[model samples]
Target: MTTQTDLIQYLLRLGDSALIQGQRLCQWCGRAPALEEELALMNVGLDLVGQARNWLDYAAELLDDGRDADHLAFRRDERAYRNLLLVEQPNGDYAVTMLKQFFYDAWHLEVLQGLSRSSDERIAGIAAKAVKEATYHLRRSGEWVERLGDGTEESHQRMLDAIPLLWRFTIELISGDDSETRLHAAGLVPDAAQIASAWQARVEQVFTRATLPLPAAPSYFYLDARRGLHSEHLGTLLAEMQFLPRAYPDATW
Candidate 1:
């Protein structure tokens, strides 16, 4: 029942989330708490950007509308973005950053693990390569969550404070819209319910170790990113990210 248009939109969701999340991580390059941590964050950001390019490349090809990956990433307005709401949120304190990354990394790994078996070979190949990087990302972020959550009183309190701010956005992580359902039914993507179950289990396991309390339930604000709705932060982010390309549309890199 799914058409190529559905597939293109689904790919955009994956590509956009990686692109925005990578940009958020890069914002910490000069401000990370330590040099070593800064380098790690940059490396992770680059990995996500690379993955974004791969997904966007395929999406561009499917569209056949003369736009390349760069165009799709840099030319789109905020309302056209399909990234998850969690990634668009501003990077708060280090604790908030780590928790946000942990939440996303957890869901990302589940989705990529399922996509590794995608009916489309290109998708499967991309997912297979991304799985290695995502596995490392999740492990690194999960460790940070534990270190800060269980470390000192101040760090522990910060982690606790971050939970409520970031938890609500997590509703999007386990839930999929109609496009995803169509793909899954066609065996082109993973089952949404299965992805949700795995993501939730991983989150619960990590939270238990960090001694962090899990939100009783996930909630969302008025917007849904899957439907081309996004947080206000995304508009600011896109303005900065897209400035050069828009200003010099004819310029070649």
Candidate 2:
């Protein structure tokens, strides 16, 4: 059986991943190389932020501590965030950002698909709604991966370099903890191992279409974000994300 603490932690992890990745995506606002791509990135960022709000609000309800989504999102310290390291990595370039999104969106689609059938009704509902959005995200990122991978000699090279760099971070997406194991046993969550297979298949299909070679797996670097350990990039991200909230302190816009 999954404890309330475990559930709350799990929800927070979900929220944090979306929130931080949304923030990272938003950095590309008005800066994308093309107008269409700029709007696409912005739209996806908003979708992720919307998902983050729902998950964070649900997490607050589970905690029953009087805090709201905003508190858990913008007011939390770096060590309090449960997001994985990949989401917090600096958006190096367009290729880097798109590669990151491609990897994450593939994993997210599989996870959300499984969650859509969860025994927990609330989780199932959220997953059902989120999977639709995630599907669009995957499509958009996949399109870009193909364009960049098969375009020009320079574009293909950049995309190729991004593959190995981003692949290193892909392992943890389907890696689970004791809480995940219990949830799986209870039918409240999908088996991480199963989700990994789906993720792998999806990735392989996309890579084949893009004509990009898959990189061999590297030594896994585990960061215990569930226990509040985070990458250094998170501090800068938090400082910017929390600046307005910290300055305004309860004042509404």
Candidate 3:
């Protein structure tokens, strides 16, 4: 059975991933290499944050907790966050950030597509709405990956370097465990293995177009952020993202 705990945990995982990644992308607010790219990134970040709000709101409802999306997103400590390690990793360079987005957006699009068909009405509803946004993110990142990878030699090398550095974190996105197993059996979620196939196909297509060689898989590093363990970067990210609200403490506009 998909217990309430399982449902809440699952939703929190989704929310945390979007929230953290969106925050990371927002750091490029005024820093993108070009004005057009800056606007694109900001638009993508807003989409992710919007998706995060929906998932977090659902999670809060499931928990019967009064905590809103702001509280869940900003008020939590590092260890309390359920985001993947990849999303929290520092945005090293343009190539690195683009690669990270490419990897994440591709997988997330598949996940959202799968979830859109979930038997759980709430999950399906959120996924139905989110999949459209995720699709655009995937397309934008894919285009950038291709441009960088097929551009100058320096850009190609930088993108190639990013592949190995970030590839290790990709495994967790499609690997299911007890929580997923329970959800799958209860029709509350889709099989991770299925999502993996779609993710791999999409990634391979983008990489091929980018003229980038895929990195060999790395040794698995299992950090279950769903259980609240997070990368060191998450602390700093939360501090900055939450600064305004934390300083004001529920002050309204």
Using lDDT, give the best candidate's number. 1
- Cα distance off (Å), candidate 1, residue 230: 0.9
lDDT of 1: 0.93
Candidate 2 C-alpha error for residue 57, in Å: 0.7
What lDDT tens digits, residue by residue, belong to model 2 across residues 1-253? 3467778887888889999999999999888999998888889999999999988999999889889999999888999998877789888888889989988898888888998998999999999999999999999998888888888999899998887766766767757779888878888878989988888888788888888987765446756777787778999989999999999997996
The TM-score measured for candidate 3 stands at 0.95
Tens digits of lDDT, candidate 3, 1-253? 3488888888888999998899889999889999998999888989999999999999888778778887898788888788877888888899999999988998899889889999988889999998898988998899989999999999999998888878888877767778888888888888988988888888889889989986665456756676776767788888888898889986998
Residue-wise lDDT of candidate 1 within 1-253, one digit each (tens)?
Answer: 3479899988999999999999999999889999999999999999999999999999999999999999999998888899999999999999999999999999999999999999999999999999999999999999999999889999999999999888989999888878888898777899988988998998889888889888786865789987888877999999888999999999986
Candidates ranked, most accurate by TM-score first? 1, 2, 3
Model 2: runs farther than 4 Å from truth?
none
Cα-based RMSD of the predictions, in order?
A: 1.0, 1.4, 1.5
User: What clash count goes with each model?
Assistant: 0, 0, 0
> For model 1, what is the error of residue 8's alpha carbon versus the real structure, in angstroms, after optimal superposition?
0.7
Model 3, position 168, has a per-residue lDDT of 83
List TM-score per model, in order: 0.98, 0.96, 0.95
What do the candidate models score in CA lDDT, each in turn?
0.93, 0.86, 0.86
